[model samples]
Target chain A: MNDTSTRAPATRRGKGLLPLALGMVLGALAMLVGLAEAGRLKPREPQTVVALGQLLDAEHRRVDLMLERGDMAGAIEALEALREQPWPDHEAGGDVGMQLRHDVYGRLLRLRLDHPEVLPVEPQALLRIAEEGLGESYRELDINPFTARLAALRGEVLEQLDRDDDALAAYVEALDMNSALLDRELAEEGAK
Target chain B: MGAGALLGLSACTAKAPLTAPAGGVDESAAGGDRDDASLRAADLSSLELELDRSWEELRTLEDSREPASVEAGAAGPGDVVDRCERIRGLADRICVLSDRVCALADEHPGEERYTSACGRGRDTCTQATEAADRCAAG
Candidate 1:
């Protein structure tokens, strides 16, 4: 009887080992599958921040050329096209690209207003979309020049809207900011 | 020990059967929900485009003068005061356009599209009008 009991316990132990081994293998496979599914196992794709910046910079130059030629319609159309393109990941350029693009769009809209004979529409609606895309980045980033320009452009738009007091205030604000910016640049030059 | 092992295996197997059904139900519930972000983005984009076009039109009118008047001025056919009146008319048109743009901007404040565009169209329109007024006064 004692022998039988001992042999029975051994048999049970041997049976438990198979299931335990199976469970371990199954658990490991599950872990690996979970990791893969979670994207933890995948290699991260590199973002092309520099390339995107270059592209945006080139676009800005083209838009600028259009503005210089007083081609307000062309500038507006080009900027609309530019805004349609996916913005670079904010992490890649730290919101600077976003701010630049936002400011550029704002400038284009203002130029449209400045030379309405060409564009014929204010583009305030389009600018609002672009601005929303720009979000807090405009406020957070050190994009004073771009913001100032936007403010100036906005002031022009306000003037077009006939809110004289508001327009004057906006222009004055822009002028003050621009003056301050110029002073800062002069001070930096002096320091240098 | 064998009994304990058997019990654990049975419990796991029982739980496993319940998991698949519960997972399916959860997935169906999630899938049935609407995606608000996509809808909002679309609405904002469309509205932004509309406002932009309007603003652009206002700007264009501000920049151009009646070619006939300019030619008349160069020919010096009209009285100086009359020519100034004509110039004032052009300026008034610009101011009217500016006011219209500002009205549109005001109509859509805090709208997803307008808010993103700069939330300052009204301010911009106001400024443009004032400038036009100044030009007109001159």
Candidate 2:
């Protein structure tokens, strides 16, 4: 009877330890999860990605103004500055910066196509840059209708380079993909 | 005391932090309200139509000459620059209107600041459309 009473307290102590261990593990897990959530909620850096997009748009307007004023040299200089701007490789919101970079490239190519004298690089080189930009845009979005317009633009560039056969092939491919590509502008205009 | 401490810990973990990802210029920051967004989008659409018509006029004046394989032979240099200036004017107006709307969206709707910004945008867009019409007529 004396041994039974002594062992009873020890049995109660062992049962008590299980709840304490479980409590500690749960507390640790809660702390870790809270910290992770805080990290995820941290605000994105301000005036880095969004501001850069605004700056690019402003510069494009400036270049257009220079062109309108018949200041070809000034336009070229502005375009060079635009090319030098460091566009972000990626952003959390839909890769906006990368898309803007492609748009800047498109503007430069259009300017060169309109006035070859204003371009610092050869027409062929500008065309190649445009082709690469459009190709990447098409692949990334997987929008087939848009590719038809891009391919038509590519055909124009190929013709500029005196590659008649290739230009014809691109035109054919664009048509085969969608005849409506020719009326793309009409659709936009009608929407207005 | 131990039980009280455990209760406090549980209470702290029960409430989670807000999950809104901050800093990017989202719709709320770009247009303020649904009404504002639809109005601005309509304004933008009108401007786009005007721009297309201007381009068509300019192309016609150029005798359908392609952008490539050409060097100022489409029309006189002066005419080309004049047409370009009109287009640039319209484009600048768009930039101004958009920037103002975005800035106004950052402020509360009840504030006078929002009213003034929207007013300016409407005025500018109206003037731009008139100018574009004149350009197309010429």
Candidate 3:
């Protein structure tokens, strides 16, 4: 009887300890969760910053569509609006922002040269924007394809402005760069 | 016990379950789609060359003062109609090519390389064709 009574109490006490231990664990978990909510831990990873790139791409396409419809004024308006946008503060070497800016400037310059009547700015101003927008930073990054296209557009602008010699030089430079890009792309294709 | 050790190890190594992207295509399938897109980007330089030549001729015409002398250099106003017709022909071919590339890129939507290449080519073709129409009109 005594043995049975002692063992019974001991088993009951063991059962009681389990609830206590479980409570302690749950409380600790709640506290840890609270700490996380309070941001004691490292911040969560940022949402993927892709929307800006997408918006720029869509806008570029819209400009193309407008141009296709011979809506010169509409195209100019869109291109100018795109140019006025603040360049995204993307991480260094991020190509999206660079490509977006270059595309906008290149297209704008083309529009200015092709349809000066539609452009709000002078052709010279548009040329200047292209020169500055497609600067050495893109070259430093070795984005040769875009650089080549921009150079070609610059040549066209120069030609329109009657700077034939400078235009010729720019065109030659663009041809060389494009040749290099083609070779590189072909080599990559071959490797693949 | 060995079982206890295994359980502890499993708990330590636990990870969230993998989930497919919103569109339901999993990573491997997406990679396969990119591979297909790569095929579409191949050997576009030849098309680019054709566009470049037409563009240069247009520029030459725009730059020239003496229409006759420019005609000698490029398509004369009579030749302009012919050259513009040729450009429109190329644009037709490019339209087909662009459609193929875009369709391939659609298999892996949002892949930047595919999107950019396809879009660039398509835009170039569209603009070139439109310019040719203007050249013809003039």
Ranking by lDDT: 3, 2, 1
True-structure RMSD, every candidate: 28.0, 25.8, 24.6
Report, to 2 decimal places, the DockQ of model 2: 0.02
Residue B1, candidate 3: Cα error in Å is: 60
* Tens digits of lDDT, candidate 2, B1-138: 011111122111121111110122233234433353453343333323323332333222212122221233443311334543434343343334334343433444665554554555555455555555655666
Ranking by TM-score: 3, 1, 2
True contacts kept of each: 0.00, 0.00, 0.00
Compared with the true structure, what per-residue lDDT tens digits does model 2 show for residues A114-172?
Answer: 66766467658866766765544344432233344445456567767766556555544
Report DockQ per prediction, comma-separated: 0.01, 0.02, 0.02
Instruction: Please state the CAPRI-style docking class of candidate 2.
Output: incorrect
The residue-by-residue lDDT of candidate 1 on A74-95, one tens digit each, is 7678766866776654444343
Cα deviation of A104, candidate 2, in Å: 2.0
Screening candidate 3 with a backbone cut-off below 3 angstroms (N, C-alpha, C), the clashing residue pairs are none
lDDT of 3 by residue, A1-192 (tens): 011221222232233455333332332222223323434211121111123433554565465456557677887788678767666433431433454456557656766666667746755876787787776556543433345557777866676676655655565555445444434433543576
Report the C-alpha lDDT of model 1 over B15-121, residue by residue, as the tens digit.
22112122223212334232535323332333233223322222222122222333233322111233233234333433443444344456666555434333343
Q: Model 3 Cα RMSD, Å?
A: 24.6
**Tens-digit lDDT track for model 3 on B2-82?**
110111111111110011121233323344334423322221222122223333232222222122233245433212334
